[model samples]
Target: GDSVTQTEGLVTVTEGLPVKLNCTYQTTYLTIAFFWYVQYLNEAPQVLLKSSTDNKRTEHQGFHATLHKSSSSFHLQKSSAQLSDSALYYCALSASNVGDNSKLIWGLGTSLVVNP
Candidate 1:
């Protein structure tokens, strides 16, 4: 079985501080890609970053994530937290190339709250 794990259920940070949301996974499936999604209140989730390449960092909208296949991890980080960055963040795994049986494994998600 394949699954994603997000250790933090809630995170709060000052407006100018750095924030990290940990995401790790265990999967038996190969040919997998990882994705980070963000959803604001009353909004649909959108892809913030995604990567299939191992050991490379992917970034979007001031946020960054590195996919380390060797470690089975894709941790999200932001150098500076902003008030607008508050949202629910999810880490998901997809095996797009694994035929029709390919499925997505999703984390429970982390809630981020940036304070003034």
Candidate 2:
């Protein structure tokens, strides 16, 4: 079984400051994909970033993440925080393998609050 974890329950950052959402995962497979999903207030959850290749940086919108297989980490980062960046962020794990149990394992979401 695979699992995703985000150590921080809440993260607060002022506008223009850098922000990072920590994410770690555990999986038996050597190759897998990691995803960062963001849900704004009253909005449905949507993928903000996803890893397509090992150790390669994947980015979307203003966020980016580099999946590190060696450390089993795929932390999402933003160069500068914005007021509109406030959302609930989820770290999830899923494999590209052909299995009936290929469901995504989601972590307890992290609340990102950007202050003006």
lDDT (0 to 1) per candidate? 0.92, 0.88
Instruction: Please write out the lDDT profile of model 1 over residues 19-79, one tens digit for every residue.
Output: 9999999987768899999999999999999999999889899999999987889999999
Worst 10 residues of 2 by lDDT: 95-104
Task: Summarize candidate 2's per-residue lDDT along 1-116 as a digit string, tens digits.
Answer: 67888957889999999999999988775447788999999999998998858889888888999988879899999999999999999999886565645567899999999999
Lowest lDDT block of 10, candidate 1: 94-103
Best by TM-score: 1
My TM-score estimates for the predictions, one after another, are 0.95, 0.92
* Model 1 / residue 36 / CA error / Å: 0.3
lDDT of 2: 0.88
- Give the Cα error of residue 44 in candidate 2, in Å: 0.6
